[model samples]
Target: MIRALVLALCGLATAATAQDTAEAALRAVQQLEAASISLQEAGSGRDRISALTETVQAYEAGMAAMRDGLRRAAIRERTLTRDLNTQSDEVAQLLGVLQRMGQAPTPLLLLHPSGPTGTARSGMMLADVTPGLQAKVDVLRAQLEEVAILRQLQGDALATLEQGLAGAQEARTALSEAVSDRTDLPRRFSDDPVKTALLLASTETLAAFASSLAEIEAETGAPPAPDATALKGQLALPVDGTVLRGFGDADAAGIERPGIVIATAPRALVTAPAAATIRYSGPLLDYGNVLILEPAQDVLWVLAGLAQVFGEIGQVLPEGAPVGLMGGDLSDAQAILTESRQGAASTRPESLYLEVRDGQGAVDPATWFAYD
Candidate 1:
């Protein structure tokens, strides 16, 4: 009986081993399915990035149009001012008559009329005068007599128009700068030119690493990723922060420089602002810490300065994900770039620098962001 019990226990162990093998196989199949899904997501991201680019271009164009409109509007504003002034004088004279009627029955001007002709003027002519004349005048005259109001209305409208035009122009100016800087951003901000060269060299080395797990799905006839055609070039605020500074030279925290600027909280989370992946992340001399991202196959996204680099080369990320934290360690140039990159802020800043390059030449960031 003891011998038989031992044999029975050995048989049960064999059965358990078979069950574990089956479970492993099942889990692997599930992971393969998940990888296919990830591939599809990647395709969607690529399309989204494309759309984002187009949207940015459109926004820039819109801002350019607004700048022109404001110029014309500014001229028209003068006309409104002059008209308002003439109307105001008429209203003031009318109010004087009403004020006199308060103390006593004011004589009607026509009834008490003393003309050069010396014609007798009756009280019926006066009937057209006095406080009772409110029916004929008050509201219209109040509206008319208000030269200040008319001038103010023109002033207010002009102020609003100017504010919008300024923002639009600012965005346009920054994007234009970026276009010019596209070819040399790395070398411009590198610790040394050699380091910038090394960064570019490393980028090519990553091409061999693109063997995404989508290959298995390709073999299995699963669908490819969806293309997001609608999202291209959509203009959106890169961050939700207040405008710290804007394009042009301005001083803050005792720093000085050229280019558009932005001031954000140090250590605040930075994001791609569009779907993208790590193109380059490492030390660039003046950038302190740097990340180069590719939002589209043809376009690059650059962010410099960080407390830590959280992503690897070729890893994908969503728009506005935490690219890095501000370590209170950006070069003045990088700060300027940040402000310039967000050119729609109030008050031009000289402390920070910003630039953008579209293809070969400079375009305005304000126009890009504002157009859409």
Candidate 2:
């Protein structure tokens, strides 16, 4: 009886934990479904871009939740299976005892070797023990049901995960197209190709190149730079990522730079941190695709290492507008699930380099961006 009670309690606890995780996964799936609907119903052009962005974000979040829940369910299933296997003999003995007591004739069941007083005492003992045994049986039944449900949930979740992956991919494609087709954003000035080429050829380093941006002649009647003094220290990060290297932090080679490196997920979206005019947007030297934004006079925000860049040079972008996407191919649902099952760390592997320039030199980006 004591063993039965212990088994029952352990099984109940396991079931409860698994149920909570399963419910969370279900909620994530519901969120993904809603996001998908929003994307499908979105209007064309700029509106579609916003909807698609939300859909991709939703899919990413849902996939993360599903991965965690499935991992927990798998662990719980293994634990319950091992426990049941090791305690099989004890469980069988318990069942046999109950069965024999139920099958015994009434006369034999009432007749005790020590006569009427012993029989009455025996009946009282049976009354107390019966309820406990019944409770253990009930718990065991519930545990079995929970295991079955978990198995079914895992089996069904794979299809939903695959759908989410496909939806995210489609949304990303649509967003890229919408951004390309967009022509409504206001331009601060037109880029001077001849002057920019000369400046790039003469500069030896990023610092030198940034310091020479003022030499690039803007189109006539260009608007003055936006005032960003009030926005200092309140700007959002351009991408969702963790800081891999702080401003002035040395890397593996013991070389340091005046910028921070952010670790991000593959193909993650990058957005403008604040309303800014694009001073430059394209590949520059060995920095891969680079984007330089001027939000205020003498202040430049340099972003590098992107797979793609959006918006034309000299165009003014509103805060949170899509800038580009990080490099690397997006992992499929199966690959992500397999990694999660193995208890791998974060999937964020791409890096974005950010440098802030104020006046004639670089400044620590932490002073202007609220990453923490």
Candidate 3:
């Protein structure tokens, strides 16, 4: 009888713990739903992109929490089932004792001479079982409460998950609309096939690249483009991120390159800051993939360190146009290189390197872009 009562109590505690886990998981899902709503209502383009990236990460985490909660609940249910099975005979004995005690009149239950020691022994035995019986009743009551709580949590989680799915769909639509809004614009200069070929074949350094493109524009009588200078202090950053390394910061090699490195969420969106012509878009040196944009007749914007580049050379892009995505993982070629060097893979946050150059030299991008 004692063992059955103990097992019943253990089952109730296990079930209650499962309910607690489910409640925590439900809270996580609710938080993710709220984040999605925030992304939808975000005022700035940069904020919207940043929130969208975070929302994706939150969704992944929430799903994992929900799965873990369900798994724990299943384990608890199995444990309760096993405990009940093991205590089946004891439970039967307990039930029989209860039935007899209830059927007998109160005086007979306490004073009847029905044991080896007659009345004294009968009373002692009843006293021994009474505490265990009350404990069993308490366990039953707690189990009922646990079941009711678990049912409520399960219902709430289900509704939240459904709402989360709808919010995710809405987020995707917003992203699509944002991207489509910047696809078309006036070109800074028409691409000359001969000059384009020469520019790609001859440039070895960024300085040389800028000079060569400038010379080609002069020869082609490139029409005066819209002044990007007016956008200084007003232009939004191409990607949603924080600047990790600023202009003129020296690297390990002591080379002070003219660019800013931005740390962003994995696979974050990289957009055009202003309408420009795509001068070059492909792999370039240690920067991985890159995009060169000529927003004005003399100035060229260098955007690099991308996982993938979109569009093609000579493709004109409006302000806020989607250019590419930051890389998440290494490519097969990069992985092989790391293996050969016996070096661990990099786990750095996705980064974008930006440089603005013109007839004079590299200038502070902070002077132009709206960074905060």
Question: Best-fitting candidate, measured by lDDT?
Answer: 2
**What TM-score quantifies how close candidate 2 is to the native fold?**
0.80
**Model 1 misplaced stretches (Cα beyond 4 Å):** 1-96, 105-270, 281-283, 287-289, 296-299, 304-315, 322-345, 348-372
Instruction: Judging by lDDT, tell me the better candidate of 1 and 2.
Output: 2
Minimum summed lDDT over a 10-residue window in model 1 is located at: 208-217
Per-candidate TM-score against the hidden true structure: 0.32, 0.80, 0.48
Better of 2 and 3 by TM-score: 2
Give model 3's TM-score versus the native structure: 0.48
lDDT of 3 by residue, 262-294 (tens): 886555667788878787778765677889888
Q: Pick the winner on TM-score between candidates 1 and 3.
A: 3
lDDT of 2 by residue, 161-229 (tens): 676667667767877888899887778778778877887888789988888885565567877667676
TM-score of structure candidate 1: 0.32
Compare the candidates by TM-score and give the number of the best one: 2
Q: lDDT score of model 1?
A: 0.39
Tens-place lDDT digits, model 1, residues 1-372: 112212222222232223333333334334334433443454443443333233233332322222222223333334445565676776677667566656554354333346633334455445565445666476565434443343333233333334433433343344333333333112111133464465445543222112111111211332222222234446453432334444344555655332234444333334556656455567654545657655543344345445555455445555544454444432232332233223333222112123333333333445434322
Model 1, position 284: C-alpha lDDT score: 53
User: Which scores better on lDDT, 1 or 3?
Assistant: 3
